[model samples]
Target: MATDALKNVRIRIERAAQKLGSKIVPDWMLEELVEPEERFSISINVKIPNPLNPLEKIPKKFKAVRVWHRKPDPADIWKGGLRYHPDVTLSDMEAHAIEMSFKSWIMQLPHGGAKGGIAINPYEWSKDTLEDVTLQFAKRAIKRGIMSPRIDVMAPDVGSTKIIMDWLRDYYIDYTGDNIIGDGVVTGKSVGKGGILGRESATGLGMHMALQTFCEAGEICLPKKKTAIVQGFGNVGSNFCKLAGEYNISVIGITDQFGGVYCPTGLDIDKLINFASANKYKTINGSEVISPTYMKASFDELIAAGADMFVPAAMEETITTSVAPKMNFKVVLEGANGPTLADADNILIQRGIQVIPDIYANSGGVTVSYFEWARNTRKFHTNPGILIPDNDETSVKTALQVMFKKNGNALIKVAKKYKIPYREAGYALAIERVAPDIKARNRMD
Candidate 1:
């Protein structure tokens, strides 16, 4: 399956190149094109070796590429996220890297994606221990020439947070003798560390917008009989729930690492947020009409909870062949990249589920990260003061407003421009723009 995804990605790139009448892109360029595949493969292989282990087994030694330097050349910065999961792999990072590159192109970002992660249970690690691990990872990545603030950049991803990002970035800074010039090497930093506002909610906001776009296109009035089930309630899931409520969509079910929650009537997001906030990290499902029911269950149960939309914000491979056939939803908005495996995707597509591919569906976080990268580069070069202090949020907000402001016009425009799915339109627009840039660079050389 991993090999197949990589092959498909390669075919896509080659087809894209052919359309431009260029020789096939170089292998190195191909790497950038399908970086996420490499990362996903490595992650899945390492975390889940066999069927017996399932989700319980953990890898003994998690491999990672890290680096450390006192000073570096100017063209080595890269950035992306680091995941902590039993199933993390280099292929997973590779897949994300490719998207980061395309996403950067879509937004006209100067940087590209470079993801990293460890195959371990983040839940088992303490803060101090995690910091130590981060520093070690940073040193290793730096030594391998796989990381730099100069060319490749990094941010937080699954099982990682602002604290981890701060620790990793600080390690880089300290190793470089406080190279103030390259602080932007690591993004998703704390606010004081130059991180942008709305970082936490950026992905969720984008998912909501994508859903809104999807809804407006079909003329489906939301929250009318609409109910949603979010598989993961961390930053992405919770934020998505909040935004969905704002749009008047009823999030009837939500789950976390602990358990699942459900209600017949709409669940009050504010109440759920407050309850989950205090109860460690458990699921909250209770209401006057539906009564409270919480228990330890598989993530698949959430999908079958009978909602209009099922959002797999949890992790990759959550919805598989066994699960997709049972899901009863109109649309599946992939909040997490690669959430639905290829086999499941085929099943869901045949089952009439509108599967929003991750490449376009989950691009919001990276889109904003691109904004941060743009701001950082401008500040770094002091290049005509091109840094955007407030434009990232404003621009995306405006674009979304345009997308949803008038449902009728937006629907007609989207339908007429592309008779395909909304997800395809979003990705096609991004890919079309990026392909030209790649071609222009080749021509210049």
Candidate 2:
């Protein structure tokens, strides 16, 4: 099955290269692209002794897998996220790790790609139970020499949160006998736990920056009152909406897993944020903020509501071939990894809708993670009065602009030179950056 998946990915890469009218890919590049350096799977068993029934201890078993698509350089700077989902498998981890490799390369970060997650329904586990399981997993990973600040940095992903990251950090520190660099071993921690200031909203801000840069390069004028439809009001989606005002983009429609709300005149982002904050970030329901103007909508309805831009910040493969043709937005900026499947790329291209690839569009989180990791490695304690500058909103925004400008320009150059969709062009550019590194290290020879 893994071989078949790799073959399929290679076929897509070949097709994309052909469409670009570029030179044929070297055999070594194809080989490196289709294989990962390492894959590890571990089984974690956590015993939760029932207080009511002291005689019986329930043992929950979780299957976890981590994949390093490309090993870190000598300095050992590698990055990825850890998710807790019931359906996660080794194959999924390997594929996502490969995507992370491309994402990091596109951003020009000095890190390779790695990803791991456990097959457990986080919603079903008690907070204490979850922490125990996470600690157990961290212990096993550290014993295997795969979890550390310079080796493999873990962050939050779906079904995971900052609290879980804090637990991971604590467990790692315990195991390492209070290593000073332990805090850097896991990112996405709460501000009180050594996390960077602007790390939370980095991805959303990055998306906005990508949109603005893409528009300027295309000579497309954003509507004076620019409106957007965001699918998924999770961390990325909500933060995007929260910071939309910076770019003069108003979110007219937003959705969660349960349902959606739409207002033609634009819903109040602050009000929606307050409502979600008060209600566990669920759908906006029938609140007065959504009163007469806001109407409940479906996923399909919201996507086709004819907004100026559509941001799919939700799950992967959401924008499939069937849905791509019906999408009415002028532009589609992916805020989630692989939100649009491979086959859907041509369909959206035929409709003349530009897509900002996730590799470049949703890289804000990793960029900020890099910043946090850098802070951890710096010698801030050398002088008592010296303080490390905080990564505020303005600094994050500026850093993202620089990153977006460089990569966005590369996206355009590759797309125009190869005459392919932006997604394929991004893949080509990222591969160009990464493949050479592997060659330089003589790993692909």
Candidate 3:
């Protein structure tokens, strides 16, 4: 008997297909999409031992879960993010890993999908204690042979940062005595520490590219001053707004966890960014700030604000069925994973609101992570004296633009040929790419 959660996932999948006016996808594909090849639960003690109580050697234990969606290929490469959220669960990890696999396939990366994360709010831990927790987790994973440069590479995700990624890499290097391939073991590090340039802005850049491609394909001429409303103000949202400004897309309304700011004329993204930077990147209160033109608004008000584009960059399932009908944007660009629920997708399609699916829109991070991994691996294999050209912001940006255009064009082509929604078209294309490998490995029924 399927659990209620499993049943809900299946219903969502079926609803997605129905929205596209297509039958449910293959059973094998559906099975592989939800099941993990391997799962791991790790428990580590974060507290120090007390000499007074010798019997209490083990302190408070922090739990974590890791999942690999499929066995690594011949090169033994698997890639994913290491999130650190209080609500991290085994089921969530599995679902996220599966989506990573789809994302990798859509981007045509050779690596399989994997995810690992500790279930703790990093804000509660001191810097030193957080480092210790990260080190213990890495040690356990490395001991199990599930984490390495050529095996499983990890990047930052929700509640994780470049600082934490640097810690993971440094700890691994210290453990392995400065191994040659150490840098490739983790990505999203500071550029000075062997991280690639433009990695920080990759996801947002990808979102910009996705929206551009979507507009061009639909023959919808964007306004002279493109307008947008963003639902999240975190790294992804802020960076996305930055890129949008560069592309002439003025963000008129923006929201965070607390509240939002809206302006008909448009908010100065750079000034807003500076203000948020000074205030710990919290919610932007227009009234409290120097800008009287900006008014405080609710998240729903921001979403419903008329704009050229609607971007949900925060959490999943934010656009529910009821919320979908109220959205008044030319298109919805998914900057976060599963931002729109399947039921909402049907409503959006009926309303002629196109959605550039998360798998296609938010793939920039992983794509650039692949670039960093390749660069590191190349450097590791080459002679130290040989100077391999390092990738810069321009090169990374150009490569991402090319990829976004290519994939976006392919997705539009599929959608037209099959007469399906863009989301379904993306899934079909990704499944087509991954199905052959699964069949070759004799995983098909």
RMSD of every prediction: 7.2, 4.0, 4.5
Q: State the weakest 10-residue window (summed lDDT) of model 2.
A: 379-388
Q: Which scores greater on TM-score, model 2 or model 3? A: 2
Number of clashes found in candidate 1: 49
Judging by TM-score, tell me the better candidate of 1 and 3: 3
lDDT of each: 0.60, 0.78, 0.78
lDDT: which is higher, 1 or 2? 2
Q: Please write out the lDDT profile of model 2 over residues 1-445, one tens digit for every residue.
A: 7533333344556665455333334665566666778889989999987778967888868899888887435554678989888878787677778778878877777778888899988777678789888988988999899898878999998788899998988888888875678889988998777788888888998998888888888635568779899988878898899999878987888876778888888888878877876774355654444467878888788877779888998766678878998898888888986677777878888898878888889988987887777777674454242233466767656766787788889878888887777778877887766555666576544
TM-score of 3: 0.89
Q: How accurate is candidate 3 locally (lDDT)?
A: 0.78
**Tens digits of lDDT, candidate 3, 1-445:** 5433333344544544444332234655566566778989979887755569855644777898898886424554888999888877777777677778778877777778888789988777668668888999999998998878888999999889999999989888888876777899899999877899999989999998887887777634667788899988777898999888678888899887777889988888888787776664355655336487888889788776779889999876788878998989987888987777766778888888878889899999998888888788774333232222348888788878878888888888877877878777777677666666666566453
Instruction: Please report how far candidate 2 places residue 299 from its true position, in Å.
Output: 0.7
Ranking by lDDT: 3, 2, 1
Put down candidate 1 lDDT per residue, 1-445, tens digits, no spaces: 4444344344444444433334434444444454342222221222223347654744434555321111111243455677776666555555556555544443334444556677766776556456655676777667655656565577888888888878877777787775654557677778777677777788888777766765766634445556888888777888888888676678877776666666657667777777767654334533222345433334566666678888888776677789889998888888886676555656876888876556555666775665565565565344231234464556646543442333323333443465644333433444444554554555532
Using all chains and alpha carbons, the TM-scores for the candidates as numbered come to 0.75, 0.90, 0.89
